[model samples]
Target: MTGKSLADYQKEYERIIFFDQPKKDILLAGLKAEMEKQFKLPTRSKEWKNENQKVIAMYRKICITRML
Candidate 1:
């Protein structure tokens, strides 16, 4: 994606995280899917990689693991 769009996505991500519109899982999954879907971009751009890693880490912290 272009730098402008990337910046816009980041801004949206921040708003969702702050105001809790997406509730974490949706945002992370959506972002990961978007990142994977756009894998044809040049290898030099690690932006998606960084974003996925961060969101995965955050998910791991709060997500429930064991079935009730």
Candidate 2:
């Protein structure tokens, strides 16, 4: 959990959403495509949805930590 509280995560998420608004679509599409390619999951399946959400959440946290 990155040793951070929920509030901290929320704040980071909001900050990123605001500052990265212009490139959000591009970032999301690229992340989704990368996940699809790496996992080879069926796009319409529930598993894909779950994994995608996990990837996005992780990505956001990583961004906050300056890992990406």
Q: Which candidate achieves the best TM-score against the true structure? A: 1
Candidate 2 scores a C-alpha RMSD against the true structure in Å of 9.1
Per-model TM-score, in order, reads 0.39, 0.35
Candidate 2 per-residue lDDT, tens place, 1-68, comes to 23444345455455555446557545544544444455453356776667567554655554554443
Residues 28-58 of candidate 1: C-alpha lDDT, one tens digit per residue: 5565455445543323456765756644443
lDDT of each: 0.46, 0.51
Give the Å error, residue 6, model 1. 1.3
In model 2, the clashing pairs are none
- Once superposed on the true structure, which residue ranges of model 1 sit more than 4 Å away at CA? 1-4, 19-22, 40-68
Candidate 1 — worst ten consecutive residues by lDDT sum?
Answer: 59-68
Best candidate per lDDT, number?
A: 2
